[model samples]
Target: MVTFQFIPFQEIENLGSAKRVNKLLNIVKENKIVLMEGRLKKQEEADLIEITMEEISPKFKGIELSVVYPNKSKQDFGQKVKGTFANLLLGDRQGMTIIGPASVVKRIEQNPNKIELFTKEAKTPPAKRYRKKK
Candidate 1:
């Protein structure tokens, strides 16, 4: 089973960038993938990278951080008009940010409509061969 920790952006919205970075780091050290609603602030992202680099070691692998950006599509004229107004008000639809150890997280891919997570296998079972007798 896949397990992850979740942090709502609103939880850290009021905190300073440094505090946000620290909170994220502490949770990520527990070695579970984190799914955060809304992206991290620019300053917080930068600070997180800097701090992670400083603390990196041979055994302690670094984190894989990624954002799944909102996608806007144009199809119908009426829908387009509505979307434009929504964009003006909301800026952009908030997307998810994932952070976790590179060892476990593996890779993250962002597509127009979805975020794909690829993780390392915890254990692999040996392959079995089946034979059909004629």
Candidate 2:
């Protein structure tokens, strides 16, 4: 079965960049999808990918990550200013971040209005059979 873990922004707000990335990676490695409250900084995202690459193996393939944030291009000047102030004061808690194990999460697709997460089918090993000996 697929599992999802929700991490609140406050949980990682105080963690260092490395720690935050590690925390997310650890979860993904366990085949669990992480639904993070807010997006990571660009630098942090890059670091996460770099680290993930280094840790890739036969069992731990990698991670599928995506961030869904609001589009500010169409916002008015006043709204943009308010958003900037909010971000400055409340940190970058404006979007959702999704991180999942690459083995389980095939791909993540996003559109302006929605997101689609495709997952791989779970394979079950065949049961062993025993025969009586004479």
Candidate 3:
């Protein structure tokens, strides 16, 4: 069995509107993988959250966990499924998290034909111009 933590992006509401955008930026820096909904709250607040894996809960049917980066948070009932996640935390700012348990992972792994990765070697850049003298 497996369990997952559900993180919503609207928790920043409590922070007030002025720092909403700033808070979102900070969250991006902290978590490597995150799904952000660009929409702001009524008071104009963005929702940003990070998801991490954990041990399965026998009482729970699917992964249903909630965590607050600072204050407290709560989730609704009956919303957890099983599946696999291949870099579920893709660097994309807007996207839904696909939850899959062991079965899904195994099936994809065993498939003969699979999607190939498309990427090329990255190039390094030179230092920027600077003028600091006395």
| Ten-residue region with minimum lDDT total, candidate 1 | 86-95
RMSD to true structure for each model, in Å: 6.7, 3.1, 18.9
Better of 1 and 2 by TM-score: 2
Best by lDDT: 2
Q: Report every candidate's CA lDDT.
A: 0.77, 0.93, 0.30
What TM-score do all the candidates reach, one by one?
0.72, 0.87, 0.24
Candidate 2 per-residue lDDT over residues 1-134, each given as its tens digit: 89999999999999999999999999888889999998999999999999999999888999999999877887899999998998888776889999999999999999887899999988988888888897
Model 3 reaches what TM-score against the true structure? 0.24
Q: What TM-score would candidate 2 get against the native? A: 0.87
Ranking by TM-score: 2, 1, 3
Q: How many collisions between residues are there in candidate 1?
A: 0
The runs of at least 3 residues in candidate 1 whose Cα sits more than 4 Å from the true structure, single-residue gaps closed, are 72-93, 123-134
Candidate 1 per-residue C-alpha lDDT over 1-134 given as tens digits, one digit per residue, 9 for 90 to 100: 46698898778878888888888887877777888877786777888999988778886578888877545553577877776786576542366789987778888887666777888888767888889988
Q: What lDDT score is found at residue 99 in candidate 1?
A: 91
TM-score winner: 2
